[model samples]
Target: MRVLGVDPGLTRCGVGVVEGTPGRPCTLVAVGVIRTDPDAPLPDRLLRLDTKLTEYIARFAPDAVAVERVFSQHNVASVIGTAQASGVAILAGARADVAVHTYTPSEVKAAITGSGTADKKQMTSMVTRLLRLEVAPKPADAADALALAICHVWRGGTQARIAAARTRVEEKGTRT
Candidate 1:
């Protein structure tokens, strides 16, 4: 499966695409950041994000999109912007008719580094090693995005199975 992972932020949204399945070595298809000037108006920044994300969806044609779930932050403004950025990613995936899933930061970190409390350096090192890249992706965001993609590729099947089991339970009129 081809998965597009989005680490969304108003200032620097990270995007990465990977193709693989559970137990298979994943290939890095693409990785980059989408930057919007802090001075730019909110609408303009969102528009830029929308346009670039649409282009990515069209180009990569991913089977699924894995977005980082926005968690509340101390800075309300930052949290709001991140939630908005995440919405853009979900919208783009919907428009492309691709499944969109959200993973918490801890979930992503644990999937990549075997520990939810892994630091950025550890996460970066693991991502570099997993992708077999000569060096870690820069700016942290890029590496985080790739890590998100790897998480989805590695965990998606199990997640899907769990969801299916829940659905079956619900159909049988059992409380979950």
Candidate 2:
């Protein structure tokens, strides 16, 4: 099963691709951040995000795209931009015929670290250990993306879980 995890922001968006079997750890296919100038016009930033996200969807060909839900800590502007960025990711996935799913920060943290109130460092550390990565996913955005991926993996989406089942079926046939 393959999933594209997205951490959306107006200035910097993070993306990750992960694949795994049912009983094994997820393998990181790719992980990185997409950045735009915060100084740029909002429309321009949105366009840039759209372009980059479409490219990512094309390159990764993910079965599903998992994005973080919008929850404002304090800044209204930041929340608005996050919603826009998330829209871009959803549109990108829609264009590619891939389904999009949204997970809350607490949900992601709980799935990855077994705690809803897990800190960034704790989430990062758990993501690293779960994926067997040598270094933590960086820039916080990327860690969040990886965490989103892990959430979807742990919760089992339709596409991802279905793909995993197919692989198991084929493996069983081969064994027989």
Candidate 3:
């Protein structure tokens, strides 16, 4: 499956694309950040983000989108910006008719580094090793986005299959 992972931020939204199946290595398709001027109006920033995200969706044609779930932070303004960016990401996936999944920071860290408390350096190292990249993706945000994709490929695939099985069983019972 091809997956697009987003590390949503108002100023620098990171995006990564990978193709793989469960229990296998994933190949990196692309990695980059969408930058918006901090001075730009909020509405314009969001629109710019949406446009970039839409282009990515069309270019990559991902089977699913994985986004970092927004968590409470000391700065309410930062959290709000993140949440809004995340909403745009979710909307991009929905508009493209792809399944969207959100994973908390700890969930992604655990999946990538075997510890929920893994630091950015550890996460970056793990993501580099997992993807077999010669060099780490830059700007922590880019690495985080790749980590999110890897996590989804490893965990979300199984979850989706189980959900599908349950749906099939329900349909069978209804038919009966």
Best by TM-score: 3
The positional error of residue 167 in candidate 3, measured at the CA in angstroms, is 5.7
List per-prediction Cα lDDT, in the order shown: 0.91, 0.86, 0.94
Candidate 3, 9-119: lDDT as tens digits: 999999999999988889999999999999999999999999999999999999989999987862686989999999999999999999999999999999988999999
Give the range of the ten consecutive residues with the poorest summed lDDT in model 1. 71-80
lDDT of 3: 0.94
lDDT of 2 at 84: 85
Single out the weakest 10-residue window by summed lDDT for candidate 2: 153-162
Cα misplacement distance, residue 58 of candidate 2 (Å): 0.6
What is the C-alpha local distance difference test score of candidate 1? 0.91
TM-score of 2: 0.86
Query: Candidate 1 — which residues are off by over 4 angstroms?
Result: 161-176
**Over 4 Å off in model 2, which ranges?**
72-74, 157-176
RMSD of 2: 5.4
> What is the Cα-based TM-score of model 1?
0.89
lDDT of 1 by residue, 1-176 (tens): 99999999999999999998786778899999999999999999999999999999999999999999987853686898999999998999998899999999999988988899999999989888888888788879888888888899889977888899999989889653
Predicted candidate 2 versus true structure: per-residue lDDT over 1-176, tens digit per residue: 78899999888899988987545689999999999998889899999988988988888888789998887673785788888899888888888889889988888888777799999888889889989999888889998897798778767654567898999999999999
Q: All candidates' TM-scores?
A: 0.89, 0.86, 0.92
